[model samples]
Target: MAPILKISGLSKVYDSGFTALKSVDLEIDKGEIFALLGPNGAGKTTLISIICGLVSPSGGTVVADGHDVIRDYRAARAMIGLVPQELTTDSFETVWATVSFSRGLFGKPKNPAHIEKVLKALSLYDKRDSKVMTLSGGMKRRVLIAKALAHEPEILFLDEPTAGVDVELRRDMWNVVRELRDGGVTIILTTHYIEEAEEMADRVGIINKGELMLVEDKAELMRKLGRKQLRLTLHEPLGALPEALADHGLELGKDGTEIVYTYDSQGERTGITTLLSDLSQNGIRFKDLDTSQSTLEEIFVNLVRNQQ
Candidate 1:
């Protein structure tokens, strides 16, 4: 099946001679949740803006649901819903009016039932008659989402959708996103929270310094980049790690009652058995052992650092 969205050789250069995006190529499958991860100034927002027709790309092409974003702007844009980072809305307008206005701007006929459904989906049905200015920060954020959904686009772009919201609102938004995906809406989200992406995304894409770094299945990425740590709680304090264990890059705790061994899970050998045997021969005994696998956050940091 053809991708729901396709970006090829995409590049964005500004008048200041700064390149925000460089040769980014991506394909988002239908009904999949794809997370774009990167540090500040990594071109995440720039990429989204270009795709949503909010910003012009200096080079490359983007096709959304078989419609060219540049040539078929109306059809391409009509199929996309964007929730930007900044909260810009009609403060004086009631929620219902604002959302209804957004839908009409898209040349969509009024569907009061659809509007009510969207408001209820985002938990803003009660606030429909309230002015946007009177709503809380989280509520206002929901209003933005409501406005975006009012048009009922097939693809959704959420750029830092949960950035400044409280935990409760964040969780609520995730639930909504999951519901959208379950309903076969393609979602492309850029987030700073790795845990959110880890929990919600089917695939992950990492971009850095205006370049596309890596894109892979979330589980495959984790298995490929994640490492395991062997933490040993010593039965007795040690003055220092013996010379024999120095080559293993073992980390000694300040109190000398703990030792940590970091090893690649994909290697031919994890070296745990050898390390333990060597420790026993060297008169180092441990009372307890614990292991941990690297999380998506760790892998993401390592990738960005490697690029730098």
Candidate 2:
């Protein structure tokens, strides 16, 4: 199937002579949740803004649901909904009015039924009559989501959707995002919360310094790059690693009371068996051992650090 959103050689340069995006090419499949992970000043928001037509690209093309974002601006933008990181709603407007107004901005007809469903889905139905200022921070965020969905967009861009929300509200937002994706709305979200992307995204894209570093299936990314560490507690403290075990990539820690071995998780041979046999041959004794695998957060940090 063709991607719902296609970006080819997209580049964005600001008036201040700063390049916010650099030759980014990506394709988001229909109905899939794609998480874009990046550090500050990493062009994530710039890319999203260009796609949503809030910002124009310096070069290349962005196609949204078969419409060119630049040449067919209205048609391309009509299929996209964006919830910005900043809170920019009118404080005096009632929840229902604000969301309804959003739909009209896209030239969509007044559809009370659709608005009500969006409100209820985000748990904002009860607050529909309440003024925007009267609601809490989390509720206001939900209001933003409701407004985004009011137009019934085929693609949604959630930029820090749960920024100021509580833990419970963050989980609630995750459920709402999943529901949107399940209902055939393609989602692309940029979040500082690495765990959110880990929990929700089917595919993960890591961006750094205006360049897309890697984009891959979530599980496959983890498996291919993830590393495992095995730490063995020594029965007798060793001052240093034996010459025979030097090839095992071992580290002596805890004042020489622990032996640490790092290995590729995806490797056909982890070298654990050989290392263990070598340890026995060298008369090295261990009291206990523990194993750990690298997480998505670690992978994200390492990627960003490498780019730096």
- TM-scores, in order shown? 0.93, 0.94
Q: Model 1 lDDT vs. the true structure?
A: 0.93
| Cα distance off (Å), candidate 1, residue 221 | 2.1
The C-alpha stretches of model 1 lying farther than 4 A from their native spots are 244-247, 268-270
Q: Each prediction's Cα lDDT score? A: 0.93, 0.93
In angstroms, give how far residue 308 of model 2 lies from its true place.
2.3
lDDT of 2 by residue, 40-120 (tens): 989999999999999989999999989999999999989999999998898999999999999999999999999999999
Q: What are the per-residue Cα lDDT tens digits for candidate 1 across 173-279? A: 99999999999899999999889999999999999999999999999998888988889999999988999988788999849999999888665264887898889
Candidate 1, run of 10 with poorest lDDT = 264-273
Global lDDT of model 2: 0.93
Position 82, candidate 2: lDDT = 93
